[model samples]
Target chain A: MGLIAREIEAAGLPTVSMTSAWDITEAVAPPRAVYFHAPLGHQTGPAGEPDTQRDLVARALEAGVSIEQPGEIRALDLRFPDATGWEATAYTPEAIPMSPDGKPNRGAPREPRA
Target chain B: MARPADAVPYIERTRALYARQAPYRWVVHDLEHEPPPWTPIRSSLASSRVALISSGGVHREDQEPFHFRNDVSHREIPADTPASRLRVSHFGYDIRDAARDPGCVLPLRALRELVDRRVLGAIAGPALSFMGGIYSARLVRDDLAPRLRDLVLRQQADLAYLVPA
Candidate 1:
């Protein structure tokens, strides 16, 4: 997708890209509309979360159409501060491993699976 | 909404409603010359082939989830993930049913809308998906790039509209 961004633009059409991972987005530095979302795997918004989905789509469209100049880049300004808002109620971020090899072997009591 | 039993690799109809919001930034821009000289894209509501790359540590239930504990590890789901077998591993968004309708995030319907509006050609037949929590981007450029390149090639895509989770 990174390499294709330029070629796509070269074909005369603009592009809008998304990434929840800040590092990846920053590195690719795609040459089109880009958004750095807070949630992972939910850039388009949350599934079954209609409003969130619509908002993201609207923003992406806005990013694509908002471009006036030839080489303009816009990053969607969206954030979630509290869980009261659109927090992911499904998946959870695994705890960081304290081991040197990057494996989670802390022997922490596992939350009994449902 | 239940994710479809026969769906794409993406999560079903989930939505992202931002709680706080981020400050907009233009890290680069230069779209006049031949190669455009590192110009940044636009920032408003424009139209384009928006592809999504979600992190939420998603993976198929039948297969192993990507490294969720690592901050710099990631895996890409080809456009051919058994639409129905996809699932989210991260606890960021409620993607229960969204994997069934990946379009909710990739917006294949919206892409059709854009196509109807004369904005773009066509949505990439097989849009892409990813598992998040990757910290180091070196692998993205080196490893991820080639994999994505293959996807674009297989789909004959002109552009890649990304949606990161």
Candidate 2:
């Protein structure tokens, strides 16, 4: 996530990535980026949690607008009202293999379709 | 500016958790004491295609699941990764149905909607996905970046929306 942001930002496009994992976000630290305290797998807020989703998305869009220099990292101040802690929940990780047209042949090999 | 106390418990907890996990020490420590933001540039997506990547560690059946053996740490999947399908790999939210919808988690639908609304110039084909959980710092920096570079370039993606899972 961070690396892709770095490449995009390096390519001269301002980029901001929303990451739940501070380690990854801090390291990748694109020119403009934000970190969320949400768990991994749901950085854009709790999946279908509409209001939470709206707020996070807004923050991400805002980061792109507000950033002023290179390698900046901001923490988006949004959270799920019901989350007990970062450790209190579990989510199933799913695969999104690119369709025949979507695969990036030069990058990681497409995982075989199930 | 401030939010209600209940609205940010996760923020407070995440700070405490980061203290305990201390996972970000390396990156935080290495960054210039005060790095700044860069903006005001044109949307790179203006003339070129764009892509979106996620780290929720979501994947499909035939695709090998990210190494979940440790129960505590996992591998970093890069942006260009291709899964036969998608899933919701986290343990927090209960939006299972939305997870399957792909639009809910990956939001290609939202981007398309943005294009329809003219919020964006266009949609980039070849959205990307990553495993989202790896714990090792060396691998993420050294390993993942190169792969992401290749992915975006191949897609000819001028911009990318990286929504961490």
Candidate 3:
């Protein structure tokens, strides 16, 4: 999403991406992105909630035009009902396989935030 | 401007969610980049030709689904198409929310409403929709982005609103 948005902006059209992954967006640094703390599929807001969806989308668009610099992202300033649950299954330390060194085998998560 | 410090938790949350779903595992993307390119809107929002896009893998009911689990292919969705006529097929995110109300990700309804209220001049044309989980920058650069660029140009859109997964 980040790379694609950058490429589009580079082609001379302004673009903004709505994202559930602020970590990744921070790294790739698109022209503009709206960070949503909501779940992956609910970037605008919850399903069946038109007003919230409209508000968030409109805000992102407003940011796309009004924001002066490139590589900017504003967090979606609203709370959503179901933004959790990956905490349990994403990388349970106990559920991770054990390595040959007897330490928990785990893949790297997000890199340290810059 | 936002400091990187403020982004720590959401970044972790992003990596956690990705780790939960994807088969191949790696750290979240961490790279330095030049400032993104810029293009100011030439006209006011009320009279600008706006376009909408989404990485939610939405497509018309008769169109084929994005191919493969990790696809770089994209689909074209008409601006006036109803939300019920579209479907989601992305591999990266939970499709349940989008399936129930694609406006949550695609926001076509909102775009149209804005147009109706004269907040926008008009919808440019069909919006580009993609599965967007392609990890390779080369593929997105060589395949998907060009096509979308062409579509945006064809529509003469003054601005684009993209909801990426």
Error of 1 at A85 (Å): 7.9
From the highest DockQ down, the ranking of the candidates is 3, 1, 2
On the 0 to 100 scale, the lDDT of residue A3 in model 2 is 56
The CAPRI category of model 3 is: acceptable
- Give the lDDT ranking, best first: 3, 2, 1
Here the TM-score of candidate 2's chain B is 0.61
Tens digit per residue, CA lDDT, model 2, B1-165:
122232223334434433545443334423576443343465533343546666555554444455431122233333333322455444323334335444445655556545555555665555555554444556776667556656565665555667765
Task: Tell me the alpha-carbon RMSD of every candidate.
Answer: 11.0, 9.4, 7.7
**What ranges in model 2 sit over 4 Å off?**
A11-13, A21-28, A35-39, A49-59, A74-114, B1-25, B33-40, B44-48, B60-64, B69-85, B89-105
Off by over 4 Å in 3: A83-114, B3-33
lDDT of 3 by residue, A22-90 (tens): 666777777777776665677778899888877777776776677666777777666667535543443
What TM-score, over all chains together, does every model reach?
A: 0.51, 0.61, 0.80
**What DockQ results do all the predictions give, each relative to the true complex?**
0.19, 0.18, 0.31
**Comparing 2 and 3 on DockQ, the stronger one:** 3
Question: Of the candidates shown, which would achieve the greatest TM-score relative to the real structure?
Answer: 3
lDDT per residue as tens, model 2, A39-106: 44455656555445544565566565466656656667665454555344222112222212233223
